[model samples]
Target: MTYTEAAEYILNIPKFTTKNKPEHTRAFLSFLGEPQERVKVLHAAGTNGKGSVCAYLHAMLLAQGKTAGLFTSPHLVKINERIVINRDQISDDAFLDIFEFVLGKVKEMEAEGLPHPTFFEFLFGMAVTAFASAGVEYAVLETGLGGRLDATNSVQHPLVTAITSIGLDHTAILGDTLAAIAFEKAGIIKPGVPVFYADTTEESNRVIEQRAAELGTPCKKIGKDAYEILGIRDKHIAFSCVNAYYGNTTWSLNNIGIYQPGNAVLALEIMRFVFGEEGRPDLWREALHELKWEGRMEEVLKDVYVDGAHNVSAVEGFLRSLPEKEANIILFSAVNDKDYEEMIACLCRNVDTDFYIITRIEDKRAAHTKELQHIFETYTDKPVFVRESLEEAIDFALEHQHGRKIYCLGSLYLAGMMKGYCNSGEQ
Candidate 1:
């Protein structure tokens, strides 16, 4: 199949299926000769910050002169962004070739009465296959959903596993309570594998600790005390770490959010655990200072910022990490499944936005603009605008921007759609 046809095939399949079994992935991988088994994996899972943590790990690994692969989910733009080797996305030619090969394997499985893989599972398989073909030494995997039943967990072994800050997300499937969500995220911790996690809420910490102890796994909790913050300003952070492997050496990341320092620490701890203290501090400094993971805290225009803060915790971080300057307007959208009520409340209560524009995004899961505006009304009495089109939303936000900042947030789908518009010079 051609690239377009392959994409159509994958996208046509249900985004998520009720059956989240790993057996389908196992069977499919076996048919493809078990490519994931060939590479050393670094499995990461969490409700938020998994993508940034994986991006940091990929950057640091490459800086150490090692071949690394990155597999992330819900691409902001193209599907190729989800699969990368040596910092480059899979090319159209390579994607088409892999799709054709994997299709053959799928047919073989279907003939044997095996079930088909979901959209996430198929993409993850392609990433594993591509990584194996490239002979990457390490593959940094970001779990699509909860860790326990995630397709990425099909990988038998990883050099080390990390569970970043866990919060209440995917409450319908993963569970509603923080402890229940933490239990799901902790599923990546394997027997005897060294696990590292962010020192987050007490509920999450207890769940993760208990899971690790049950498996006799050596677990380390990287808390605030493990790192000393030197400065936080201008959407950048500088910190020094006193963790077990890392000395109290100072490091800084430019053009990133305040919440990123913790994620960076998690990635650094993983690198230290796997490759030892041989990594030069200079390479790390250069790499992190220039690290770019789109749609997190990306500035699409001169004074406008866009973020994908769809959930409550992420929205809280976005609001907390904002510069002290007041924002002129906030354009937002979120899928129906998310807790947009709490997200809206957080943004309204924290940041003083003169205008709030609720817009529709390019996703079936998106909450309607009217519905979102109604929810926002309950929290804030600010002037709220509704626009069905993203371009119109941008226009409205800019028209109301009186020299203050225009912040677009709420959903990654919205962020991606806005990024595309901005790149096309349509802003």
Candidate 2:
């Protein structure tokens, strides 16, 4: 099969439950020789920031001259972006070659009456197989959804497991409260394994700590055991590490947001914990600045900041990163299942921001601009322009932005789409 054909085949995979029975991923991986066991893994699970954390970890490892494999989900532009080696997306030849090889085995399994794997499970199997065959020294796997039953959890002997901040996301699967969500995030913690806990909510932290105690894993909090961001200036962030293997060293993070310090510190701690003194601080510093985490508080164009702050907690972090009450306009859109009201409401209360609500295309989950317009009327009498697509949204915001900054938020999918548009247009 060609890469395009292989991609089409995988897209037909059905998403299944977040349950404990790993029958699907197990069967798929077993057919592929369980290659996930071949490399050192830094498995990460959380409601938000998993992708960002994975990118940071991959970058750090690559800087140390280690060949790292990165597996993320729901690509913004290209499907191959979901599986990367040393910061580069998988190539056409490799993708097609693996897909054809895997396809034959999948057919054989089905011929023998084995249950077919879901889209995510099949991809997981393919990625691990590819990484193993490619001789990846390390693999950073991001959870597709909730942790415990996530297909990526099938790996054993993870070098370190880290949880980004826990919050109310995937409530139907992860549960209602912060504690319930934390339980799902905590599912990644295995007995005797070291876990990195970022600066999360106190409530979520308690739940995680309880789980760690039960599992007999040492859960080290980033701010307490490791270090965190001491301060931030325009385009520069200062970070320090204490319990980290890199020791008490501080450096500049080229990323724009202060929230990244948590992920940065967590990455350093995980790297040090996994590699100890062999861990290089210089590599960590170089990678932190050079890391390209798309749609996570990224500035894709001139004076325009894009973030996939789909959930309430993410929105809060994004808002916290912005300057105080500097009047501006927020160009936003969201998927239907997200807490758009709470997210937009939080932004409204926090910033002197106006709204230019846009409707994302193609995805059935997208919320309509009319719905957002109605919600905005209840919150503020500020001007709200409606657009059908991201291009129209960008143009509208730029036309009226004048000296004000443009913030595109609410959905990561939309951010990806806008990024592609900007990239193609040379913006």
For each candidate in the order shown, give its overall lDDT on alpha carbons.
Answer: 0.87, 0.80
**Candidate 1 stretches greater than 4 Å from native:** 15-20, 232-235, 243-248
* Model 2: per-residue Cα lDDT over 153-266, one tens digit each: 888679889999888877877898999999988888988898998767789999889999998999888764455667767666786766434556676676667577777777
**lDDT computed for candidate 1:** 0.87
Candidate 1 lDDT over 1-427, as tens digits, reads 5799998898876844446488777877999999999999999999889999999999988998999999998898789999999979999999999888887888888799887778888899899999999999999999999999899988888888999998888899999999999999999999999999999999999999999999999999989777777887566688888854455566887655778888988888888788776866568767887887789878888778888888999988887777674667899999999988889888888887787998998888889889889988988889999999998989987876768788889899988998889878887
Largest TM-score belongs to which candidate?
A: 1
Candidate 2 Cα lDDT to native = 0.80
TM per model?
0.96, 0.94
* Alpha-carbon runs more than 4 Å astray in model 2: 15-20, 224-231, 242-248
- Which residue pairs of candidate 2 clash? none
